[model samples]
Target: MSAVRLISNHTLKLQPQRSSSQLFRRHASSSVAEGSFTARRGLYASLLLLSTGALAAYYFDSRAAIHRYVLTPVIRHILDAENGHKLAVRVLASGFAPRDTQSDDERLKVQLWEDELSNPIGLAAGFDKHGEAVDGLFNLGFSWVEIGSVTPKPQPGNARPRMFHLMDDTAVINRYGFPSDGHATVLARLRARFPIFYQEGSEPHASLRSNALLAVNLGKNKTSPVESADDFVSGIRAFGSYADVLVVNISSPNTPGLRALQSHALLEDLLGRVTHALDEIATSESNKSRRPKLVLKIAPDLDEAQVDDIAKAILQKSVDGVIVSNTTVRRPSTLTDANKAEAGGLSGPPLKPYSLATLRMLRARLPAAVPIIGCGGISSGADALEYAKAGATAVQIYTSFGYDGVGTCRRIKDELAEALSREGATWMETVQRASAELSLKPEDRSAHTSIAQLTKEAEELMRLVDELGERVGGADPSKDNSATESTGVLPVVSNGTERSDFVLFSMANARQWVILDRSDNAASPCIFATLAYEAIDQGAQVASSNSKGRTISGTLMYRRGQLLERIPRHAEASEKLYLDYKIKPTGDKDKKLIWAIA
Candidate 1:
């Protein structure tokens, strides 16, 4: 009877069936978990879409709007000038700086140091003293990006307020005395950058990103000796394999004695050492036979003599190139900005006249092979094209870039391309035309060539021959001398048997000519002989026969136009050296016939 009652109680409890509610509660909790998981995934997807949209907006759009309307104004107003410059660098280095995506116009393509640049526009140095933003600057569409006035050692440079903005004049004046992170740090950056794109035994300039060049502007430390090339040499050793071009920064007026390097003697020594260092670097197996192009940056403040001296030295040293100007100390009276009076190197519009004049002078002095990079007072496409017309191979901008913001290079390129289209010329065509027309030509050498100059040369040659006759008797002209035969192509014998004293101005050319002057006084019969003058390192050789009998030979020379070194040639002492003969009378009677020896 007890067992039956227990069974009945169990059955009654089972009949209530509370397990159904428990099952429902479990299902509800499971549903809630699944809904939570789905909502979280949806939130993640939404966030991802928003982030991608922001990035696309930042990167795919034109940088000009942000640079002009937002970034530039904010930076300029928020921070002081130097600090603002620092901020700009940091922003560029951060890789978020707005970049121009427009392809460079085909007309803007040009050459710089054997490399085809996408555009002729480049960014000048001083904006990135430490080489902190080379890639960043290049990303903005500059065909060439020059970095640093880097020193052998770190320096504080000039005091605060060293940079002054002449907003009214659209110019900048900075006495930044080559403040730098020094060779070690800068070199590390370069080394770090090289392996990213280049492999072992490859050329940094020709192999990695050939369309754009990375040039480092080398400067001396404040304490280093001005005459000593130790700093530049060391810089070459440190960065030669890494940089496309190494710029010798001797033109900065802020440095105590830097400008003095432009003088003949000092410049020769400096260039010699720098070139030697470069040669060594090129030959070094560790450097992969990479020959870094060497360029000298000069000042716009140079005088005529100084400019001539520099051009001659550059030719003599076989320098790769020259930057027409760094900056000017001369303040134009037209500058209305109060900061114009500040003590610093002046740049921008005021510097245009000086820089352009200097460039034209240099173009007139140097051969077309040695290119001049124009920098200064370039704000517009017209300005850059003006430089091209004035014989500049490429144009660089500093003050204009600073004043105009990130769009400077693009704007200049666009404008330049438009100008080029209007003129029906390519950038190379324009540069070549200007170079051919404006650059110094062989035919029209120096201005000092005249008949009197030839007479003076004749006298010097005679004197030298007299001296040489004393040492190594004059060379026999009839002998089978291959060198002589090769040099004298159009041999012209003397017309008269009088055997009058004649100076043979011979070049390695076959052209033949004999110039005779119809003298005003019939008895005198003065002859004016003008010859082509070829400037050479070794002065002209002098050789002559003594009035009695014996002949002498040696080199006798003089400076041409206070610039080129004259090298006189001594023809065979036995035979005369004239190709043809002619005489003409001048309009002015009794005017002494001056034979200008070029």
Candidate 2:
């Protein structure tokens, strides 16, 4: 849901960050005074240092002044969370909306449906745990939003610091373990958003807020033994009447015994019963005309066979949709925090590729029409498009929005729009087709470079061989087949203006370029994307278009946003080499990517 809060910790981080900045400022001032010339001047500098030290000491120890000063004003900016919380209790709060024109102010209506987003995008399960923030999150603009892992009895979740912000890490480690205020608490919150009350048998549900398309992520209680179906059913049953969609969460790494529920036999039984229950609910509501969509959020750490098993279970069970992944147990090679040794799954940039990999696998194995909500490490529009390209129908962003705030959503949407437009499509469906052609799986990543380069080389060689056979003829076998075949031609390089033997090639002493044999250094899941930051330096035009050839590898091309084939790496070599294309310099193409030159 939204960056899984550690909700209170959001304020906690801000306090510490301010103190760290002050400490640095004090250190800088004290160091400069060491070079002063005269005794009187030195004494004055000492006094200034003392003043700085007191401020530094006060700040580092705790934010006594900031809490008294800054927080009151900051909270005031959000129309006062205090007042907003009151609005939660008082359904008839004044000044919600609608003071504008109607009949006379007719305008041309553009029925623009959001490019049906197929990226790893969806709301985190708990952001609207009670469905309280659904409308608000939608107002901020997201393709889809998730609410709840709502429990029947309501849960307080794990204890404090259950959620921690690993800031320098650009990650969050949380053990929130499905804390929710319960079905009634959320239904009340959502009901308050509406102008009318909702009738649930004799009960009523309504809210002043109701703008978001909701997907309800459900889980078993910490107290409940995950082995049993009764616990899960209890939670899912309560929200059935109100939820727009229901997600069976069998993969929260934080929750004890959560992954155990992911076992195929256990999962099939659970899903079968759950879907059956929802099916009956839908049937009963046929008169009322509403049936909540059923979806599932699984873990990223799952292996291929495990994914296949789950996919099979989903199919056999007749379930609805699937969210590709949850947080990761494996930390990345890029993790900079020494404190990262602490327990809990790692989320954010390190999880993007892994999450996308799971998504691609699901798309390949699962039946079509089984909608997938993508989530993990999506911070920008390009990242969203990458998820879309990887076969996500829509994506959920938690970390980026957590760090960057609500503005991140609009930024991602705008950027994704730009990406779609660049693909020569004004509509999202077209972009999705383009992305489907480009999606790559994780196992396909290793040979990305060699496969791409060799393919381009092979194409050039084939073209030349065709010309040679026609020119020389079979009568002069040496001049014909033997000439180019027996002796390989050196590739012609193109300089800025035209083709040449020597194009300016530079050697890079880049530290990151060193690829090690062991898993220790390359542990970062994003090592591929990290290397891709240097893709331009290799002077190649890379485009991901899903295609098939025995020699071509999938992993390499997918990183460039091209997923031409679903086939894994070839065990045997073939004449048709598949890989990224290395572009020769030409003034027109060379100028397009400025970074490629230097």
lDDT of 1 by residue, 1-598 (tens): 1122236546622334447678799999999999999999999999999878756644554344665567677877778778989988887888887677888899988887667888988889999888787777887888878889999899999998899888789888899888899999987877766657665338647225768888889999999987898999899888887788889999999999999999976786677667767777776777755678999999999889999778766764668899989899998889999888899999998899999999999998887888999998999999999999999999899888777688778888888999999999999999999999998765322432454554444343333332322332334434432332112212112342221222234321111111222222211211221222221123434333334222223443433222221222111100111211111111111232222121
Query: In the order shown, what is each candidate's alpha-carbon RMSD?
Result: 12.8, 27.2
Cα lDDT tens digits for candidate 2, 441-507:
2333244234344344333333333332322122233343332321222222212222121111111
The global C-alpha lDDT for each of the candidates, from Candidate 1 onward, is 0.70, 0.51
**Candidate 2, which segments miss by more than 4 Å at Cα?**
1-121, 195-212, 285-288, 430-598
Report the alpha-carbon TM-score of model 1 versus the true structure. 0.69
Best by lDDT: 1
Give the TM-scores of the predictions, in the order they appear.
Answer: 0.69, 0.53
Candidate 2: 10-residue stretch with minimal lDDT: 569-578
Error of 1 at 64 (Å): 2.4
